[model samples]
Target chain A: MVRLITHNLLACHVKGCTTNNFPLVFQDVQVELQVAEFNPDFIRNMLSRLEWTALVNAAKQVGDTSLPPEQPDMMDDELLQKLHHVLMEIHVTDGAMVCQNCNHIYPISNGIPNMLLAEHEIG
Target chain B: MIPTPDLSHLTRHDLEQVYDPAEDTFLLLDALEQEAEALRKERPLICLEVGSGSGCVSAFLGKIFGQSSSLYLCTDINKHATRCTLATGKQNKILLDPITCSLAGPLSSRLCHAVDVLLFNPPYVPTDTDEASSAQSSADIAGSWAGGIDGMEITNRLLQDVECLLSPRGRFYLVALKQNDVPSIQSRMLEDFGLTSQVVIERRAGREFLLIIRFARTAHSGSGSTS
Candidate 1:
């Protein structure tokens, strides 16, 4: 899942299952980038839903390869382009996304993340 | 460089049982093995062969890649295909160890989200009388080819389940016939999954060229239908 969308639905699957568990935050991410064409509209449309801090931090944890450390205060065309590439173009084909709080690992394979929980892990 | 396996001495029927290996297979195999070897020190390598006809490529691949201590899983919708791969492994003095040789469905939990590299050469030819005949004459009905009217019948099904088998740090190499509807697949991956993919290798075959696609991310959202 894109950090933009992974941020939306991920809640800690702990017993409480509270809203705060959301964004399950990234820790020690190892990022790999494969360049892709930029599509501005897609980024603009996705802006409202993104967890700004989470996206920025996850990008860093994965690797400081690209993307600014912080989201800009204003949405400039150039900045939006960066965000576009980060969200849509950069490839995260491989790597594990470990949740900060629950330590749940979501493995990304061939660029697809497996979010399914084990039978015992299911609430 | 890895040792090249001996691919000679098979009888005509034996070769017939072994599906035609695409020319691109060699090129992609070379490149993929290079990348895979680089990471051998870091992780136990896992490779999957999709639609592995006669499973020779997987056997060859397993022999080469597994030489330095990596795990190889050869899978095909057809059990016969995997058997063929296993047969070659037996003859080549490769994959003698139980842990190193395996054949199963793409959906098996063992493979779910656990592959390092996936090599696929699907039957993308539009369904025709020949394919139907092929399916009918097979000892096993399911393993034969039922690519639907367009020949992408199995391709779509494979794609959906493939994501689950990919390891977090894995890469996939998918081979499709030239006339196959690639745009449909790409759009599904890009728009629905929010992935960026590329045609990494191409081998021209008459009017149609076999394409090798590499998916860089999963689909975030989109319509998934078995139709």
Candidate 2:
């Protein structure tokens, strides 16, 4: 659940903390790299859906800076391969995804991120 | 028919915490299989399942679309269920990412109108409001079927999000019982969200009359959700 693809989709959902929630700030993460079967089409398709800044910042938070600050205009194989690795292969087995806006912590343990909030925090 | 996902990896202890794949699960699988041809043609990229109990249905979806065509995302309140879902993906050679959270709660905003395929097999058993809320709070096996009021307390929450969740070409598949008032569900989705729907498949399993209803934006939008 710590895959960059999934991380990009997660935002702070705590009660009343709405604005500037996207791109949850990652902190104190233990990263694991597992090779996955790569599909260029999937990468290319996901490219459109990805929040480029969020992904780039998240990749760096987990200690990988290979991704460019901006999405490359060229969708070449070289770029696709890089996107595949950064998005699919990197796994954060332990740590927390802290919300920049609300400071809520979403923990990732044993490779699954617990995004469940407290009852009062659920909105 | 595509073979069901292998669940031999799931142990007895796992079932105690997670909802086991049973009649309702297979019914969702069967409905998905029935829609395989159209689903593939759409070439969907994002597939999300709410309350993915054993991860069986999403694994079957991987087999249908092939492993690399879509990103399979699942959400479950029960921690064991999410872990079981990840294991089932590994067992079946599919990549499934599971998040421990209530039904699509954490995913709603980022996935805004971006989900190509949405699924939910919510707790459809009518129970007391307190029972349902407690089950939801505890986030265990009981949460799988403790539907409050008209067996729709949970499903109703998701209904508010569906209109905004679906991509232009997106389709949502839901599992419900006849007691849930299937007709009213259809009418509300049409009247409120402008989403036209049709019952994809239905079966009477034991005393439960289960149905799979598929919904999408109206046909006049150039994308036909119905075959």
Candidate 3:
């Protein structure tokens, strides 16, 4: 599923797309929220690795605006719950992940993102 | 022994398109099972499988973790493989997020020095360059085994990015064949990227000799990046 957690780890890999390609923009996306076993500790551990700004951008793009604009230095349970919801609960069931740099459209269907590039677009 | 992921949900049509989990897949699972305690102790947050054809290996890894906190990420060229991977993950109750991409093409940079456990059971059969290219372009079951030029064409590209993708304490488990020049692969990784490796497990699977080589950063290589 296209969770913000996984989406945070994807960028446009189109040929020569070396800059401004992070947090692939979401467009016309159908988002689903499924019950998941939330582990606050897992979110805490992943906090350091997460690109806060990119994650916030992706969350908002997916119609979620729970996270604050800037990440809090100290994470409380309330903040962690919000992080878990934004990152883990929101799944992009159908839509396209567009590259901001090269404008390459990576379609997402059935919760799977097709990141394959065309022959001409391959680097 | 760790139990294999339940893949009964996959239909015969699915197996024909996706690479079926065979001896090679089982061997990879066994290797991971052997390292269960060590892997769990590491508490790896991000685990990625480069070509998760059947999602069997990654799903098994998830099983090893029990209450897995890790994010199991997967990538494959074949669309059918991705579909099957998701099905298998769901069947096994493991959340394997798969992307339909060539190897880890789009995720390399985003995953920079973040992956803790990286597994790859690549296409290791040595085929002609054209045949391999065609198989890759077709992105079908053939692409699962057509390894161009000594079965290193596809693996070599991923090797170049491994150092950059792995975290300081990351481990990369790769399944290779005897024909792929295993010793040379080990040497190249050491000389080129300062990544030392040990053959985790090996077996004679019919006519094909399979080995799972595990690589990790050298003791002194504090950083994952080359620069």
Residue-level lDDT of model 3, residues B1-227, one tens digit each, is 77788988888999989999998998889899898899888788999998898888888988887534889999999999999998889999888899999988888988898999999998899999998899999999999999999998889988999999998888999999999999999999999999999999999999999999999999787554442
Please identify which of the two predictions, 1 or 3, would achieve the higher DockQ against the true structure.
3
| Each model's lDDT | 0.53, 0.92, 0.90
> Which regions of candidate 1 deviate over 4 angstroms?
A1-123, B1-4, B22-24, B27-44, B77-80, B96-107, B128-146, B218-227
- Candidates 1 onward: DockQ, in order: 0.02, 0.83, 0.80
With a 3 Å backbone cut-off (N, CA, C), the pairs that clash in candidate 1 are A29-A62, A31-A62, A94-B168, A95-B168, A108-B168, A109-B167, B113-B164, B192-B221, B193-B219, B193-B220
For candidate 2, list the clashing residue pairs, or say none: none
For candidate 3, give the lDDT of residue B143: 91
Q: Residue B131 in model 1: shift from native, Å? A: 4.3
The Cα error of candidate 2 at residue B114, in Å, is 0.5
- Model 1 Cα lDDT, one tens digit per residue, A1-123: 233323332344533343444455554344556454454554564455356766776555555435565666677788877775566444454566565556777665443344544435544
How would the docking of model 1 be graded?
incorrect
lDDT of candidate 2?
0.92
Model 2 Cα shift for residue B147 (angstroms): 0.3
What level of docking quality does candidate 3 show?
Answer: high
TM-score of chain B of 3: 0.96
